[model samples]
Target: MINAFMQARTGSTRLPNKVLKNLQGLPMFIQQAKRVQRAKLVDNLVIVTSTDESDDIIEQLCNENNLLCFRGSLSNVLSRYFHAELNYPCDAIVRITADCPVIDPELMDYVINSHLKNNNDYTSNCLVATYPDGLDIEVISKNALHNAYKYAEKPSELEHVTPYITSHPDKYRLQNIQSEQDLSAYRWTVDEPKDFELISSIYENLYVKKPNFNYQDILELLSHKPELNLLNPQIARNEGMVKSLKKDKEEGYE
Candidate 1:
């Protein structure tokens, strides 16, 4: 079974108790989990939180929803993920954050299908699609995760999560599924106050009577109201390391 495992905790330094923050009468973490389960691509979905004291609320929410949940080290996320893969019956694991409210299930299916079709060990939508924020998806074989658990030695790898597995192109066959329709300017993931505000706007406008619709339905609604993209102009970018490396090169550090 392919598992979409979400890593979440209340220890977020930037926004404390952000996951417990309500999005239309529902906790943000729970809402994100529901979206993952609703996705057509994921065979099974599990919320992976930490054993830290702050994550108690996450554990309770998981129990109430009857969703599979795992708790492990707060900092060493790679180990937490590996433990989840071992406990769950997952052949491949999809790494998803608990902050994405507008995660595209169709795009997730595309990434998983592309990985298996191309016989790649690692695949992701963020590698190429660049569809704003909420559409990020990463699929990696269980073996690759185990390899990361054992071999990844850097503190950044333990903290920031899956980069070690994807960075080694020689060891893992990495593939990216690009969006053919060109919807790269959309924002859906929740990070800061502005991100949460943007996602709340989408939920307010789209998820009124029917809170459960696939990605295509979302696109149809969003296309008709193109101004929603302006809800948050500064879209989040996951290219921090790349940007830092470029700066280093300019400063003669590389």
Candidate 2:
């Protein structure tokens, strides 16, 4: 069974409680979860959040919405993911973050299929980043996740789940899914207030017409209204990972 673990927390440094921010009357993460449920290949969807007291609301929100929730370490997200799998066993794990409210289920299934077909230790779309930032997906084998959990030492590796595995490619088989057209220029992730505005605008424009709007639908909408892209411009991708890497250097892990 393939379990998709969506890492979420209310303690975002960029935008605190950002996942709890509402989009179209529902909390942002719930909206993302709804989209993730549309993927046919994902046998189960689990919300993996830190056990910090601040995240009590996240668990309550999950319970209120009838979504599965697992609680683990607040700082070490790799530990959170590892323990989540221990509680809910699966053959492979799909890693997702709650910030991407506009994540594409079709894209997720595509990556999952590739992971299974290639029998890769790790498979993801973001390694080369052909897709938009918000559409990133990572499929990790049980063995790979276990190895990463046991061996990862750097602050960056521990904070972001797959960095250790990705860094040591020789130890694991890896595959990256690329889009035919380069769409990395677009950003649909919610990291700041401006990003939320762009996501809200996208949902306002597309969700009413098709609740299950794919990335293509978003692209089509953006094609006519290019101004939406300006809402959250100049923000770097994976800012959290960058910060963690800096911490790793400070701690002499680099």
**Could you report the Cα RMSD, in angstroms, for every candidate shown?**
3.3, 0.7
Candidate 1 wrongly placed segments (more than 4 Å):
216-227, 239-254
Worst 10 residues of 1 by lDDT: 239-248
Identify the leading candidate in terms of lDDT: 2
Q: What does candidate 1's lDDT look like per residue over 1-254, in tens digits?
A: 68999988887655677888898889998877777776676889889999998898898989998989999888788889999888996778999888787776766888888888887789988776556567888898988888888987666566556778777888989987777666677767665777787778778877786787666776777788877667677755654345544654665653
lDDT of 2 by residue, 1-254 (tens): 99999999998888999999988999999999999999999988999998889999999999999999999999899999999999999999999999999999998999999999999999999999899989999999999999999999999999899999999999999999999999998989989999999999999999998999999999999999999999999999989888998999899985
Residue 74 alpha-carbon offset, candidate 1, angstroms: 0.5
Among these predictions, the greatest TM-score belongs to 2
| Model 1 error, position 101 (Å) | 1.0
Q: For each candidate, give its TM-score against the true structure.
A: 0.87, 0.99
Q: Cα deviation of 143 in candidate 1 (Å)?
A: 0.5
